[model samples]
Target: MMLVFALMLCVPAFACLAMAMERHQETLFGALLSAAASRVLRCAGWSALFVALWLAVAGKGWALGLVWYSGCTSLGAGIVYGLLIVFAKRMSAR
Candidate 1:
């Protein structure tokens, strides 16, 4: 269950980070995302945050849920950023 939550939390973080970076935008999504990328990423990030909040509230309580949501989002964003950096480096090398 925790694993499922963790993976769910990662989706938006990864999407936002990937779309925010030009290297990732070109490498992963290609030209299809050239226009409206920022808009899409913004929506995705907000949606993810909402989902995290919902999950936390459902899984725990109000106070604990908010805390959980914050921690999870932060951790997930950090992980996605790190992965993006690694991927960009590898792609640039090749």
Candidate 2:
């Protein structure tokens, strides 16, 4: 579904965007913003995937149509985003 694609791309895109902007500033705000953005993206992707799974389990195509995205509080998302941030940090060292 469209939701799946959107969130999948959004997560990486946000991280990439934040990583790209790292050079614009080195202040605390910039770092915090990038971190937050990465986290958001990660969580968004996780929510998308998780909801998609739930939909698949429902076994009803009609039921699957309901758009369910986590507003937040996804442990998986936090973990994924944290890894992304770490990877981004390592890559940007160049």
Which numbered prediction scores highest in lDDT against the true structure? Answer: 1
lDDT of 1 by residue, 21-42 (tens): 6666787655446557766786
What ranges in model 1 sit over 4 Å off?
2-7, 20-32
* Tens digit per residue, CA lDDT, model 2, 1-94: 5445434544454444334344423422344345676566457645555555454334334443333234222433565468666765876785
Give Cα distance to truth, residue 50, candidate 1, Å.
0.6
lDDT of 2 at 45: 48
Give the Å shift of residue 4 in candidate 2. Answer: 9.9
Task: Quantify all predictions' global Cα lDDT against the true fold.
Answer: 0.70, 0.47
Q: TM-score winner among the candidates?
A: 1
